[model samples]
Target: MTSRIDLTDKAKELIQELTDKHGPLMFYQAGGCCEGTQPQCFEKGGFYPRMNDAMIGLVEGYEFWIDRDLFEYWQFSHFTLDVLDGFGPGGFSLETPLGKTFKIHYRLFSEDELKDLEPVTRY
Candidate 1:
C-alpha cells in the first residue's frame, strides 16, 4: 500500500487558489542539478500516462500528489511547503524530511515534461 502525502495549511491555501484559477494542479519532479534532488511543483494539466507509485491526497478541496519513490527516499522525515521572500520574486520552498530544502520557481513546462504529470485526483 502507498502512504498519502501531507500538505501544510499554507500549501493547501495556495493550491486551492491555484486550482480555482487553473483547474487540477499536477505535481511532479524531473531532472535536476543532482542525480536524485530535483525541483517539484503543481501546475495545470490533463491526465498523465506514466507515473511512479505516487499517492494523491485531497484536503479541504486542495490536492497533493507525491512521488512514492521520492517520498520513500525521505522516509522518517517531515516536510513542509511554505511561501518565502527569497528567490527574487518569491516562491515556494520544500523542506525535505532530511532537513534539505529546495525552492520552486514559476516556469513553463515543456511538451515532454507535461506528459509525466498525474492529474490531481479529487476525493
Candidate 2:
C-alpha cells in the first residue's frame, strides 16, 4: 500500500539519536501561524492530538500525525519526512535542543499510488 508518509535517511538517523535519549517518539505537523509548517517531535503521548488531527502513518514505528484541516489541504500528495541541520521555529519539538529540525517534502502521488492509498486514523 502507498503509505501517507515516509522518512529520509537523515531523518532516520536523527530519530535514532532522539530515540536513544527519549525512548519512543511521535510527530505532529501543525499548520498554525506560530508553529509554521514544521513537524514537532514529542516523546510519545507528550502532546495530545485533538479530534481534528489525523494519524497519517508511522515513521520507523513512531506515529506521525497532522492537523485534519492541513491533511485535507494536502491529501492528494505524498509526504516524506526529512531533517534539517538548524533548529526550526517549531515550539517544543525535541530536536530544537539538538540543533535539528523536522520537515516534510511533498509530491503529488502517481495515479497508481493514488489508487492504493493507506487509510488515515483519526485521533
Candidate 3:
C-alpha cells in the first residue's frame, strides 16, 4: 500500500541521530494561527496532542500528526519529511537544539496512489 508519509534520506539520518540522543520521538504540526505552522519534533509524549489532531502515518517508526483542520486540507497529498540547517521557530522541537529544522514537502497523490492510499486516524 502507498503510505501517506515518508522521509528523505537526510531526514532519516537526522532522525536516527535524534532517536539515539532523545530515545523516541514524534512530529506535530499545528494550524492555529496566522504565523503558519512549523513542524515540531518532540520526544514521544514530550508534546501532548490535542483531542482533534490527526495521525497521518509513521516515518522512521515515529508518528506524524497534524491539526485535524489542516489534515482536511492536506488529506489528498503525500507528505515527505525533510530537514533544513537552522533553528526552527519556537525552539520547542528537538531538532532545534541541534541547529536543524524538520520540514515537510507535500505533493498531490497520483490517481493510482489515491486508489490504495493508506488510512489516517484522528484522535
The positional error of residue 115 in candidate 1, measured at the CA in angstroms, is 35
Residue-wise C-alpha lDDT for candidate 2, range 1-123, written one tens digit per residue? 999899999999999999999999999998787788889999999989989789989999999989888999999989999998887875589999898899899999999999999999998
Q: For each candidate in the order shown, give its overall lDDT on alpha carbons.
A: 0.42, 0.91, 0.87
**Candidate 3's residue-wise lDDT over 1-123, tens digit each?**
899998899999999999999999998888856325778888999988889889999989999999888898998998899999976666878887788988889999999999998888788
Candidate scoring better on TM-score of 2 and 3: 2
Q: What is the C-alpha RMSD of each candidate to the true structure, in Å?
A: 12.3, 0.9, 1.5
Clash tally for model 1:
0
- Which 10 consecutive residues of model 2 have the lowest summed lDDT? 84-93
> In candidate 1, what residue range of length 10 has the lowest lDDT sum?
88-97
Arrange candidates, best lDDT first: 2, 3, 1
Q: Which window of 10 residues has the lowest lDDT sum in candidate 3?
A: 31-40
lDDT of model number 3: 0.87
Residue 87 CA displacement from its true place in model 2, Å: 1.6
Better of 1 and 3 by TM-score: 3
